[model samples]
Target: MSTSRMPLALRALRTLLWILAVFGAVGLALGLVGLAVMTEEEVVRETGVGRSASMAALLPGFALVLVEAYLAATLIRGGRARRWCVRVLAVLTLLSGLLGLLFLDVAGLFEVAVAVLLLALHESRSAREWYRSGTETGKPDGAVPAPTG
Candidate 1:
């Protein structure tokens, strides 16, 4: 199918993923800069947090950004693997949100929102049709109806 005819759900999901990837990248860059410019002693003095704790916190976020970037690419290209990736990523995101909640962090709300949006888009009728069509062709909505005899 032409890009113009693509499902709205797929388009929304792709857009959301890209937005998340960009934000995560920006956050990671800022984090790296903060780390570079500040000493462990300074961090402890300023925020009562250790440098090791900050580094540990960023690692999972960095991993999440990598996953979001990969998922965005897979969603565009469309394959059976993309379906699996969506499911797995959604589950992981949900788990992350739950962990955040356990820690009483407001950031958990964002993670939960991302997971809900991801699942909702994947499960929409239009997106499912789009994925089914793509799976048949192993290409991004490339399945075409047979010509009339």
Candidate 2:
């Protein structure tokens, strides 16, 4: 990705991804703390799930959240592959969010919204051409090239 004249979609996606990562991490931490504070019997009585089971359930989410953070970090550098990375990650996020819904997680809605926005932004014409141009010039499609000496 060109540092200069980066597409608004990319900029927004990158920022949003990082924000999602932060929120996910915070949520996970809170969940863990809540679990830790609860007695095993209380956990079973309250949620019909054991503490260990709940901890196990959180592992995949933590992994995926880390991946989201990684994707955001990747966007900070120059690469042709970042566009495809964003697309694939966005789909994963959407599916993950849908899976979260099955567990009655309200946070899933935020995940879905961000994923949908990421899809729309990255799929925009300007963003596509920006990736396609593959030049450091930072001009997306047909902008006039600087006259070389």
Candidate 3:
């Protein structure tokens, strides 16, 4: 949180998350539109894809925006909820990537990969700084220090 110790990548990731959330919302709206306006037969014929499969594919991104919103909210609150939110997002991103890969959809996979990589980078860098400060200076950032004999 210190201005001096801030990493550029973390800022960039935060910006990316905002952009991603907007796109995710759009994707969600499009999926809802497809569901409302198109028949199953028309969807399959127009996209060469099944309606069920298309909806399934879009659902994760839509759900992730909600997840990301939760994370953003809880992250600011700073408690167990924040930790859980980060872990959930990480796991979801990995799972989304894997699912896309299994379906042979590179676009979906790429979106997931970008999300995961940015989050992973931010977390790892933050953890590294935490570890260094704890080991070298005998203090942790934001977290309660363990009792030592």
The number of the candidate with the highest TM-score is: 1
Off by over 4 Å in 3: 1-7, 44-61, 127-149
Error of 3 at 79 (Å): 3.6
Q: Which stretches of candidate 2 lie over 4 Å from their true place?
A: 1-4, 78-81, 99-108, 135-149
lDDT of 1 by residue, 1-149 (tens): 33424578877988888889999999999998898799889988876889888778799889889988988866766667877888888889899898999999999998998999999998899887777665333245555556779
Clashing pairs in 3: none
User: What's model 3's TM-score?
Assistant: 0.61
Q: What lDDT score is found at residue 78 in candidate 2?
A: 34
Candidates sorted on TM-score, descending: 1, 2, 3
lDDT of 3 by residue, 13-79 (tens): 5566676677779879977797769998898888788888877877666678977765543332233
**What is the per-residue lDDT of model 2 for residues 5-123, given as tens digits with 9 covering 90 to 100?**
66777778778889888988999999999999999999889778999998999998798788879877766443667767778888988997898988999978987997899899878
Clashing pairs in 1: none
Rank candidates, lDDT, best first: 1, 2, 3
lDDT of 3: 0.62
**TM-scores for the candidates:** 0.78, 0.75, 0.61
The candidate 1 region of ten consecutive residues with least summed lDDT is: 134-143
Which candidate ranks first by lDDT, i.e. highest?
A: 1
Off by over 4 Å in 1: 1-4, 44-53, 135-149
TM-score of 2: 0.75
